[model samples]
Structures are given as structure tokens and as C-alpha cells.
Target: MASQNRPLSPHLQVYKPQLTSVMSIMHRATGIALAVGTLLLVFWLIAAATGERTFGDIQAFNASLIGKLLLFGWSFALFYHLCNGIRHLFWDAGKGFGLEAAYRNGRLVVVASIALTVLSWVWGYASMGAL
Candidate 1:
């Protein structure tokens, strides 16, 4: 009876985030973000195909503060997915399997994702002259 309801095993108090754990959770998170972000892409594409009126509506919405915030998140998610995907490619090649290497590469993915997102936004705004 005493052992019937014993607390299973290690608890949350013992859980420290490791690189693999972080990556695992982030991979799922980015997957969800990517899926949600696709709606924006689809909207843009449909607007483009349907002509200016529809596109203008989309543009108006996109220009709104909330829309801009969503777009920023979408952009970041895109870059994050891309960076992590590259990390996965390296893993497929049997590299960066060690804990320290995984942590290093995980950080690299985060830094690269942010950098690429900012750089992309800057260049895009510059090219379009519409910021």
C-alpha cells in the first residue's frame, strides 16, 4: 500500500533544460509557428493573384500595427525554422551530436535566425522603399 502511489520517479524539480530538450521543444514550437504563418503567405499570394483591390485590402491590413507585429513574428518563425533545419541537416550528416556541440549549434541557430530576419526585413524595406 505504501508503494502503490509513490511519486513515480524524478519530478519537475529535477528537470534542467539541456540542449536536446530545448531543441526538441523548440522544434515543435517552430513547427506550429510555421503552420500558422502559412496563412499569411497564402493570403498574400491570393491577393496578388486576384488584383489590386484585394491586394490593397491585404496591404492595408498588413500596414496595421497588429498586422505588422504578426508579420514580424511570421518572419522570425520562418528564419528560425530555416536555421533549425540547417542544424538538422548537420545532424543527418552525423555531426554535432555531443551535448556541448549541440548547445553551441543551438545558440548558433538562434543567433542566425534573428540576424537573418532583421537583415531580410531591412533589405526588403530598402528595396521596396515602403517602410
Candidate 2:
């Protein structure tokens, strides 16, 4: 066959990122993060059931700086996934279909997720007398 130069198909570099698209990608990522976070929860639970020594070790690690950072990330992921899930429900209900509405809802999901995560951490710390 004779070589004929044809235009390449559009790829990631060809498209500009939009708010809705970014949020959609984040939704999947946060979902994965939540799954991993659940594993941590199960580990903690098993440790608690096993004995004091195992539980104490888990607690100690959980109280460490790195652990706290991971917990913070996991909490944020949880809230983000939750808010995005609700947004998805709205889409399922045939709402937020317009571009403007999609952008608006995307912004709302981002703001609500951050607010909820912060509030939850604050409440948790206060309840623990660590605030």
C-alpha cells in the first residue's frame, strides 16, 4: 500500500481538561483510595480482636505522623467519593445534564467534600479531647 499521511486521533494531549472530566477522574481515584482505606479498617479490627499487644501496636502506628497523614488522605477520599456519588445519583435522575449544570455540580461536589472532611476531623478531634 502507498503511504498516505493521515491526521492522528485525538488523545489526552489534544483535549483540555474540564471540571466535570477532572471530577469524574477523581471520583474513580477516591473510590480506589476508599477501598484501600477499608483494608486498614479491617486490619485494625482484627488486631483489636486478636489481643492487646497487636491492638496497641496498630494504635501506636495509627498515632504516628505518617499514619495521621494517611488517615487524613483517606478521610478526604471518603468524603470526596461520597459527594461525587451523590452527584452521580443526580445524573442518574436526569438532572445536571447541561454543561453549566455539570460544572456547577462539580464545583459543589469539590467544596462539599472538603468541608465535610474538615468538619469530620474537627468533630473527631474534639470528641477525643485532642482539640
Q: Which candidate is the best by TM-score?
A: 2
Mark the regions of model 2 whose C-alpha exceeds 4 Å error after superposition. 1-10
TM-scores for candidates 1 onward, in order: 0.82, 0.89
Looking at candidate 2, the ten consecutive residues that score lowest on lDDT are 1-10
lDDT of 2 by residue, 6-104 (tens): 655656677799888778889999999889899889999999999999999999988999999999999999999999899899899999989899988
List of clashing residue pairs for candidate 2: none
lDDT of 1 by residue, 1-131 (tens): 89998887757468997767777778789889889888888999999999999999999999899998998888888888888988899999999978889989998898999999999889988989887
Q: Provide the lDDT at 66 for model 2.
A: 96
Query: How accurate locally is residue 123 in candidate 1, as Cα lDDT from 0 to 100?
Result: 92
Candidate lDDT values, in order: 0.88, 0.90
Deviation of model 1 at 77, angstroms: 0.7
